[model samples]
Target: MKLSCTECGQGRSITDPVWRCECGGLLQVEQRLGELDGEKLRRVFDERLAHRNTPYASGVWRYKELIHPELPVERIVTKYEGNTGLYDSEPVRRFTGVRDLRLKAQSENPSGSFKDNGMTVAVSQGAWLGYERFACSSTGNTSSSLAMYAALSGKASYVFVPEEGVAGGKVLQTAAYGARMIRFKGTYDDGICFLERHAAELGLYVCNSMNPFRIEGQKSIVYEIAQALNWMLPDWIVLPGGALSNGSALGKGLQDMLATGLISRMPRVAVVQAEGASPFHRMIERGLKELTPEPRPHTLASALNIGNPPSWKKAAAVLQATCGVTVSVTDEEIMEAKAVIDRAGIGCEPASAASAAGLRKLVARGIVDKDETAVCLLTGHMLKDTDALQRYVTREAADAGMPVSSALELEQVKERM
Candidate 1:
C-alpha cells in the first residue's frame, strides 16, 4: 500500500526515503474499502517464511500483505513486539465496576512498554529501506524501545531525552540499549518540536508517534484484541493519554479492521490524561470542535507530558468518531491506582495506572455502565520508575515499620519459617 499525505494527498513508498508530503503534512496509509478474511489471513501467517524467527506467531505479520506485500517474506524485521497477552483480572473488575474487564499488558513487551509495537515496525521498515541508523525523540519509553530494537537489527541509534526526564529507569534503559543520548534542557514536547524542525536536516528519521510507521505498528494491538476476543468489539477501551497518539492510532487501527471486515463494530474510546496536564480533557468537556491548547501542559506521567501533540488533528477525529470522553486523573489518584495495579500483580508506571484510575472514576460517576466490557491499556512497566517505586515502597514501609533488606542479602540468609 502506498502512503499518502494526511493533509495534502501526496504519496511515497519504500523507494522514497523522504517520507513527507510536499505540503509538509505527514503521510497516512492509503487504505481501500474491504474486509480481511480471518481464515485467509491465518493461512498466510502459517506459511510465512519468516515465522520461525519472529517473536509473536501473530503480529502485523498476520496481516503482512497489508503492511509490506511488496517486500520479500524474509526481509521484514520480526522481533515479536506485538501479540502481547490480555488477562482477565478480578481485581481490575472490583476496582473498575465493569463486569467484563480485560487488561492489555503491554508492559510485557520486550522494551517494557507499548511503544515497542511501533518501534519494531519502524526499524523493520527502515532496514528494508536500507537505512543503517535511526533516531527518535522520546519521553523515555520510545527511545528505549527503539534502542533495543535497533541494536537487535544491528543499526545505530540516537535518542533525545529531556534533562528532567534523565532521573528515572527509562534513562538507564536507554543507556543500556547503547543509544547515543542527547539531553535537551526542556520538556518532552519541546524536544519533539525541536526534532520536527531539525531532524530532516540531521538526516535522522523521527521514530516518535509523529511518524506514520508508528501507527502502522501500533495497529497490531487492535489486531490482537480482536483475535483474542474472537472478533468481538468491547463496549469501551480506556487508555492513558499524553500525546493522544496511541488512542488516535488505536481508532485508526479499528477503522482499518472495520474497513477490512475484520470486526463488525468499533468500541467507544475513553481518553485518560493526568490532571496536571488536562488540556485535552478540558477541550473534550467543553465539546470544542478544535483541540487547541493554551500553554504549559505538565504531568507526572512523563510519557504523556506532551502539551502540543503532533497528532492532535487525528486525535480530535478519533474522539469525535467514537464519542469518547476524556477523564483527568490526579497524581494522588494515579499513585493510588499504582497501588491497586501492584496489588493485582501487574506493576506499571503512573501513566499506565492513569487508565485504571480513569475507568474507576467513570464507573463511580455512572458515566460507564457495569455491564459494558471494558479494556484498560497498561502502557509501561512500573520498574521504569524504580526511584518513584522505591519512594512509594519506602514510605509505606516507614509507616508500617516493615523490615526492609536487599533481596540478595535476604537470600544469603535463612528465615525461621
Candidate 2:
C-alpha cells in the first residue's frame, strides 16, 4: 500500500508522517490486491468467523487484506470492534416506502458509535509508528471513540470540541475515558482548523477521518454490510453525511470489492445532509465543481452540524463513480425519522435518522424506487444524545403549555393505560 495525493497524484510511503499532500490535497491509501480469487476469499473470510482471537475476531480486521494489507497483525489494536447487526425493521421499511430495507446499526460497536470502526485502525497505525499521543476535533462521537481506544492502548489522548452544542452523554463518555478535553468558543470547523494548524507543534498524531488509516478502517463497514447480505450488493446504500469520511470510505471499499471480483455491481450511494449544513448537497444541486462551505451551519442533529466537511472531494468522487445522489433534510424531518426509529426499538441519534428522512424524500420523488432494496447506515446509538431525544419528546408539551408529567394515583395510571 502507498499514500497518494488525491489531486496532484504525488505518492509516498504509507509510513510517512503526513495527512495532506504538498499541493494541499488530501492523501488516500492505495492498495494493490493482485489476482484475488473472489469465491476463495469469501470462504476464507467466512471461515475466520469461528476464530475467537484478536484481529480475526474483529469485524474490521477480519477483512484485513482489503483494509490495511501491509499492516502486520501484531501492530493491530482492536476492541473487537464492528460486527454490528443489520436489522430488517418493518416500521423503517414502511416509513421509507421501500419493499426491503435494512438498518446497519453501526452504533452496536464497542464505543456506541461507528467511530470505533475507524478509531481502531487509526490508533493501531499510530502505535505502529511509535506515537504515544493522539488528538482530534469532534462534535461528540469521534472524541469518545478516540478517547476510549487511546486509553485502552495506554496512549495519551487530547480532544478539541466546540465550547457548546455537544451532547452531554458524549462529553461524559470522553471524560470517563481519560482524554484531556479542550474547548474553544467557536464551531466544529474552527476546532478542526486548530488541530490541522498545530498537530505537529503539539507532538500529537491526529486520529480524525482525515487520517487515511481511519478511512481504511471505515471501509470495513461496507465489507460487513456486503458479507451480511451473503455477498449480494444492495441497490442503494444510504447514510448520513457529516465529515463525509464514511461515504468516501464506502465508495473506495466498493471499488476494491469490484476489483477483486467479490461483487458484480456497485451499489448506488445516497448521502443525506442536514438542511442547515448541506454544502455537499448544495454542490450537487447547483452543478458546481467545488463545495462552498456554510459559514454558520445550525442543526438539531449535533453530529451533522458540520458546515465545511474536509472529505467533500473524496465523497464527490464516490458519488460520481457509483452514479449516486446527495440530498438534504430539514431538522424537523430528522427528528421525525428519529422518533420512528426509536419507536420501532431501533434507536439512533438524530443525525443517523437523516438517512431515513432522506430516503423517504428520495422515494417520494422517484429517485429511489419503492421496490428496491436499500440499507440505511445508522452512525451512532440513540443514547449518544439523550438531550436531543428529550427535546424532541417535550417540544409538543412545551409548545402547548402542558405539564410534561402530572402526579397520578395508581388507579389513574391504570385507567390511562
Q: How close is every model to the real structure, measured as TM-score? A: 0.91, 0.97
Best by TM-score: 2
Tell me the tens digit of each residue's lDDT in model 2 across 181-238. Answer: 9988988889888988999998899998889989999999999999989989789999
**Quick one: best lDDT, which candidate?**
2
Model 1 lDDT per residue over 1-417, tens place? 778887777777745655467897767766553545746764555455256555435466666655555666576666676667698889868988898999998998888999988777778877888788788878889889999988998889999888874337898899998999998887777777787778768877778887777787787787778777877879999999887779878988888777766778889999998877777788878888666663666666777776666777677778778888889899888888888888988778878999989999999999899988998999998887776678778988888755665455554455411
List ranges where model 1 is wrong by over 4 Å: 18-24, 33-39, 42-58, 403-417
- Alpha carbon deviation, residue 222, candidate 1 (Å): 0.9
How does candidate 1 score on lDDT? 0.79
Give the whole-model CA lDDT for all candidates, comma-separated: 0.79, 0.92
In model 1, where is the ten-residue run with the lowest total lDDT?
408-417
